[model samples]
Target: MSTMDYDEHESKFMRKARENPFVPAGMAGFVGIVAFGLLKLRSRGNTKMSVHLIHMRVAAQGCVVGAMTIGVIYSMYRDYVLKPMEEQKALNHK
Candidate 1:
């Protein structure tokens, strides 16, 4: 593609990424799950390092799935219900 077309596509992607509502939730969930898992493993003080690392990986994956599920539900609600109501309000105000 031409330079202009590439630039436009890149900007559109960047804008969508910025506007994505799930990003913050997913990041927070991932960090919290991994941190908690590590802390719990440390406290237990009996598990092998390899086992602990495996558990951490599992926790992180679970966090991603859980966060994505929550984000999808919220996004669906916002798109189906909240956005329509807000648009109607704005239209009525005009």
Candidate 2:
């Protein structure tokens, strides 16, 4: 008899990958746009460097907030829903 190699052990990894959705596509594009705008705003004019740094920091913070929203949504779904289902399924498997 030949040993069969079924990917039973990989279902969890696949499930977790599917369950986690971090940073929506639109938000990611906004982050890239902010970064690009910052690059354009890299002026060496009479303005103090610290002022421009603060502007960049504020834009970066907005991007972080957008990213965190995705994280929060993913966490809520994964922790409250998918996790329990996976646990139950695992128990049934055993």
Candidate 3:
């Protein structure tokens, strides 16, 4: 068996990439949309075609709300915590 040593240091770009807020927000939006769609479909019978329009609207609203909530929370965390940590790390590294 061969053993290798890995660098513990992280680059600035890599750190920034790790702090990406879009992934969580996008996933939340996708999940919200699907859940809303399922709930709407289950609650309303499929007999009426207009129900689909309502479902779409509800799903879209859920997606938008989910994405906005997640995005805002992450943005706040990134700005207040991650950036400061990165700055401290950079200073320590130097």
In each prediction, how many residue pairs overlap at the backbone (N, C-alpha, C within less than 3 A)?
0, 0, 0
Error of 1 at 23 (Å): 1.4
Model 1 lDDT-worst window of ten = 1-10
- Per-residue CA lDDT of model 3 for 1-94, tens digit only, reads 1123323586655553456656555556777776766676756665575767676767666776666677778799889999999999999999
Q: How do the candidates rank by TM-score, highest first? A: 1, 3, 2
* Tens digit of per-residue lDDT, candidate 2, span 1-94: 2224435566654554444545444356567767775776756478777787676667766776766787788798879999999999999999
Which prediction has more favorable lDDT, 1 or 2? 1
Off by over 4 Å in 2: 1-19, 23-34, 42-47, 81-94
RMSD of each predicted structure: 5.1, 8.0, 8.5
Measured with C-alpha atoms, the lDDT of residue 5 in candidate 1 is: 48
Best lDDT among the predictions, by candidate number: 1
Model 3 deviation from the true structure expressed as Cα RMSD, one decimal place = 8.5
Better of 2 and 3 by lDDT: 3
Best by TM-score: 1
Q: Which stretches of candidate 3 lie over 4 Å from their true place?
A: 1-46, 90-94
